[model samples]
Target: MYVAVKGGEAAIDNAHRLLADRRRGDRDVPALGLDQIVEQLALAVDRVMAEGSLYDRELAALAIRQARGDMIEAIFLVRAYRTTLPRFGYARPADTGAMLIERRVSATYKDLPGGQLLGPTFDYTHRLLDPQLAGDAPVAAPATREADTRAMPRVSEILTREGLIEGDGALPDDREPGDITREAPEFPMERDLRLQSLARGDEGFLLALAYSTQRGYARSHPFVGEIRIGELDIELDVPELPFPVPLGRIRVTECQMVNQFQGSAKAPPQFTRGYGLVFGQSERKAMAMALCDRALRAGEFGEDVTAPAQDEEFVIAHADNVQATGFVEHLKLPHYVDFQAELDLVRRMRAEAEAHTATPVKVAGKAAE
Candidate 1:
């Protein structure tokens, strides 16, 4: 039986007040604005939005501020707020093939159509901390060239045409993909649901699992077929409108990892693919997600599912940081009654053992007799 404990109300209120005070350190200093976070700390905001499963930049920035720069806490705030909002109809599938390309690169090809545009990447930057950034420094404008309006084709398509890569099979009956937000996920999930889960899954968890795969824990001999970061327009099908209504564009990152697969009896020897798509320019998360996605598909390809990443139930169950945090953090709550029961049982066992030991001096069968 559970017993409720009281009398911490005043303490709880005081603790909340202390938290507020701590959150606003140095009142003399100017407060941080939401615009500054949205523009300068863009990546952190992006992560909060992606993991929180909300796309509003302003809301994400506000959450970040409210959480005192705690990313996970900010994500929790965003998610909590998101649940209160009503759901609208799903948007049409985004066509990455026509993405307004910003940063596009391919490891497999030396140079592909729409030559590698290294747009605002830190790939070549030295990791040294610059002192200039500490103080007010004048930022120079980046040089730009005429926009490349040429069609940027996906790298996988080239391989697919030559029968060198596995093709993405058409959806059965062209059914709408499942929404995990609306329903609980089941084990042995379809790729669509799995991708949806991975898209919003904890980046660090996915990164570690992906790293494990690279270290021979379910290696697929993967290559970066393509990684693209850009903006894409979203369209929603309105029942009344004759045509799909256009929603505002959103920035996203897409990764396609090509893995070597020796042909099975049912299929020819060709390259397989793992896909990842995420909100904002989250290259690392997207890439890691793709690796994990490929690892999770081991069962489909008749490969042994021995690794943690290969276990669908394990990955899916532990992917949500919000849920994981809730389960873990809930331990901090009062468990007085439950703990008291355990304590009583332990003490009873100890007392019984002590009594038995003290009484044993009489000896079995009465040695004195």
Candidate 2:
């Protein structure tokens, strides 16, 4: 049992005031609005929404403001706020195939049905800051065109048609998904839990885990089969309604990685897949997620599970940045009593050793004459 300490209320209040002042900054400058954050700094909001497990961009933008642009802290705020909202009903799973793709690219095939569309990307742009961006000059609008209406066939489906890739026939979408927030993950978990963990996992941690696999530790030899960034419609099935009603649409990023699988005694050689889906245009996060997803599937694929990324317990357990940071940061809190007890024990041990050393000569002989 720990006793509560009194005082520091004034200091805590002052600290909060100081934080607000720092967040606002210069009085002459215009205050940064939530809308501006949602519009201009959209990537940051997307990250918060992805990790926070909340879909509302407006709330995510507000959280980013309240957290003063600390993404992790904003994520924490969003997660906490999300729990308070009532669950009306589950929405139907998004149809990725029908997504209105704005950006689509493939690394596996030289040519796809819809030749790679580099819609909007920083891939070719030189990393230079334009001086005009600093001023209030009117920014030019980008050239717009009608999106390609042709159906973008999935790269995985194409590979599977040739029997080069394995397929999961008739997926059980109605099956209950494991909620990481509600329940703790167990070993040998279902695929849903693994996907859930990676979906909300810290980007940096996932990136490192993905990089480890590429560095030859549990290497899966993966290729970006396809990556699609687009807005997907979400619908909910109302029991009274004849058909599912459209709720709205959200921007998402999806990555499908093709991996080589060597034939084993029981199974024949084929290509497998690793999938990643995030809330927005997070290509790097999605790519890293796909690689980690593959690495975590070593057990199911008959590959060696020696690496940290391959260990289910290690990866899923530490994937949550909130849990990891909370446990680690708890050290900053008062531990004086515990430290005192340790100090007492250490001092006693040292004194006993010193006393034993000082009295040692009398034991061997009569005053060592």
- Give stretches of model 1 more than 4 Å off: 1-3, 354-369
For all candidates, the clash counts are: 0, 0
Cα lDDT of candidate 2 equals 0.86
The per-model lDDT (C-alpha) reads: 0.90, 0.86
Q: Which tens-of-lDDT digit does each residue in 1-369 have in candidate 1? A: 555667988999999999999998899988999999999999999999999989999999999999999988999999899889887789999999989888999999977889888887889999999999999899999997888677988999989999999886456877779889888888879888999999989999999999999999887789999999999999999889999999999999999999987597877899988899999989999999999889898988889888898999999899999999999999998887879889899868766766879564554434655
Residue-level lDDT of model 2, residues 249-323, one tens digit each, is 999999999988756687678988788999888888898889988888787777878899888888888888988
Q: In angstroms, give how far residue 111 of model 1 lies from its true place.
A: 1.4
Span of 10 residues, lowest total lDDT, candidate 1: 358-367
TM-score of each: 0.94, 0.92
In candidate 2, how many clashes are counted?
0
Question: Among these predicted structures, which one has the highest TM-score?
Answer: 1
